[model samples]
Target: MTRRAAIEGKPVGSDAYVALEARYGHFTAMQVRDRRTRGLDLHLERLESANLELFGVALDRAAVLGSIRAVLGDDVRDASVRVYVVESGGRPLVMATAAPPFHLSGRPQSVKPVVYQRYLPHIKQAAGFPQAHLIRQVARDGFDEALLTTEDGVISEGAITNLGGFAGGRLIWPDAPMLRGITMGLLQRMDVPQERRPLKVAALPELDQVFLCNSRGVVPVSRVGDVELRQDGELMARVIGFYDAIAGDPLD
Candidate 1:
């Protein structure tokens, strides 16, 4: 496979492959390939908006799959997106949307991108079914994703996206299982201190709004854990407007 040395300031190809070693601590053949595939240039200018008050842009699956095809020279199909978007000081932030590991070492692998596995170790004391298994069950129950918080009471991210819950005049996050997303990262930088601790499912009623984020789905918080999330129409409109404005407009 053709490998790039680097992209903008981000790691790619072989460097990306190697970094997952340090991030995940051990090299499974499946993880190595997924890491490489996950590496792409995050061009915010191409996806940001006017006033620089950032909105989000959709991730083009075809484009990503095409790149993977170019690199691996193999049949690439069935890629799913995991969104992660953030806005900081009014600028849209884009970050990782990792695909599950694919075994290129000839094992006829079946991939299950389990969001629970990423944060399970951090919440071992929580009384619940295995997070990964629960996620699969949720999928079976007709939900698209799952959010796993730590024992400290902070909402983090989902099976495929980051969590944004509004309550008590602030946004909260548990700070485990996922990357501090580009959008969420920017929010934190702009004085939106994401509460990084353990969160509980029982706290849902207190949350006035809930939404998932990623660079692609730059949408607003609409629901949580089966409860109908409060809709901030103004917030949703602003986000949509921002997305529409930046998506096709010329950036300075």
Candidate 2:
């Protein structure tokens, strides 16, 4: 990911483009290139409250599909979107959604955020609808939180938090098939793991605690499936204290 000073330029593109967000000040723009799927390119921009004069552009459905037709001859019909909100302080924030997967035939399943990130342009298909679906599902499910596991069952990160486990009295995170969240990476760097692997769902019962994390920060799990997590006393206190220490200090 790269960050640069926002530049002043007029929107320049073909007829098959529509505006996504038009605000009044400073904003961050995401222009996706080298797209493998041939449709409208997914374009995103976020205007911070202080920078309200900026214009954030995203294509409307008609314009998006039209762009697809121009490139792939009108056969494409769907796309996905994933969102990440990282603090300037090196913390990573993630948000997943229920955007239905594409090139599937049956009643489509709600798309996960990771799937959206995998196919960046897909977000243009429904704009921000899937993100809304994901946020709503998180509130409804009362899930300790959800994490991304590879198709092979390696645990990575949660839609809103990173994944961690306490096994044999040691703090650990998966080594494969996951996102390697910023916090997870930090812990790993500190030599925190006792064992790391493609953690299996069958192993959940062997841990003392399970936790989730992200830039908005981490929340230790009290329960997982039929298993309940026990407080690790001092360890839990240290974790919370570390998070609280970094709460809003953007320069991390």
Candidate 3:
């Protein structure tokens, strides 16, 4: 059993490669600014829940936080961080990795709808090959990301994000199963008029605007499989503003 947080080199999880190479674990990603991040509790809860579900053991909150703090160390305050909780020999180990930070790009994205869903859709698996593959495949279609949907064209989510739409001056979240992204959770807590319902692909044109949100950031959707959607600049701005208004929790 690996008790302490695995440490390797500066702010990067050199030891993490082995765990990921096995492709058998779950993880959470977050953008850290000045060693702080929004929804730290949500992230931790995700890890704890996945750990219990996958490894049948309670997650060590201290160990997980220790690894993340260790990887960030004193050198990395602003970066992209991923904490991986993997089991080996019936014991779970905590690993943390850091990379360059990225924020929301107001640039609208065009996505292609793909009729696919992830296995164990609830847990955020550490390694996602289908998402990577679909992303590459859709890039050939001149699309930014692959929108995962049901065969019936029921909108589910992005290959790597949560889907949101604005229609009739209200925020609508897909009622389908998804990872319940940290950003989405934070935004849901805000004072936005929103609803969760089963959204369909054909409904895209009827909506005023659509968007994709993840731990990195949220961006307006310009097109959904050739269906051009209007961009409600005011709505998107307000959503982003509400997200940013939430103070980040200090990592220390």
Candidate 4:
């Protein structure tokens, strides 16, 4: 919690820090609890695939994990961990950092729809200014978050979380192009009854429940613009129960 960070094996202010300002890179965020993480393999695969796509090279998973463990040390029990791979000097520089754990408010979020879509929606790249801008704009407008949509009014996802809904005893994910969240993928692997289909802003009121999910956790959406969503407690409990059952992979 002392604002510690490192690049490669050097501290942040060293000459190697130039990689942080690189124009192209991809990163993954995860919660490290007791030196272990959930969906650790999925996180590694995401980094490997993105590195290959951007740098034409496969990321070294062991090296990446080593960097993470090096920075985390043995003292930090719970922390927010981020691993970044930046293309610099025609090569990829992998850096990992760990900080104090992030805790969400746990209160239901109120979101407002915004007309926007991410470029290369599947990759979790560092170019997030547009999405960050939308989130700030909506926050100023008295909303907790922004629900991104395409020009045709089809919901793509939230500014930071994957959007999904409960309808007729199934989990309905927006079929539009967006980043495939690790948490979302885990839920699918757990065999949660789910379907992917295009969701429109105008149909918000028709859904039985609305929720947002990311690496942190799943949260209910109490309101989408002016439409109030029914917070089905039983459904949310089941979803959380599924997430809770997943075991974390050891960092060692």
**TM-score preference between candidates 1 and 4, better one:** 4
The digit string of per-residue lDDT tens for model 4 on 1-252 reads 643455664446323434473468998989888888889989999998898898898897766887787677667778888888887678888787777887766689999999988888889986678878898999998998899998878999888899888888888989989999899888887565789998998887788888888988888899989878887898887887888789999987
Q: lDDT by residue for model 1 over 5-83, one digit each (tens)? A: 2222233454443332222111001112322312132332222221132233454334333333333333323232222
Question: Every model's Cα RMSD, please?
Answer: 13.9, 16.3, 3.6, 1.9
* lDDT for each residue of candidate 3 in 64-126, tens digit (9 for 90 to 100): 788778877766788788888766666776777777788666799998999998888889997
Superposition error at 101 for model 2 (Å): 33
Ranking by lDDT: 3, 4, 1, 2
Question: Against the unseen true structure, what C-alpha lDDT does each candidate score?
Answer: 0.39, 0.37, 0.83, 0.82
**The candidate that achieves the highest TM-score relative to the unseen native structure:** 4
Better of 2 and 4 by TM-score: 4
Q: Worst 10-residue stretch by lDDT in candidate 4? A: 13-22
lDDT value for model 1: 0.39
Superposed model 2: Cα runs more than 4 Å off: 1-132, 150-154, 191-195, 245-252
Worst 10 residues of 3 by lDDT: 1-10
Ranking by TM-score: 4, 3, 2, 1
Regions more than 4 Å wrong, model 1: 1-136, 150-154, 186-198, 239-252
Which has the better lDDT: candidate 2, or candidate 4?
4
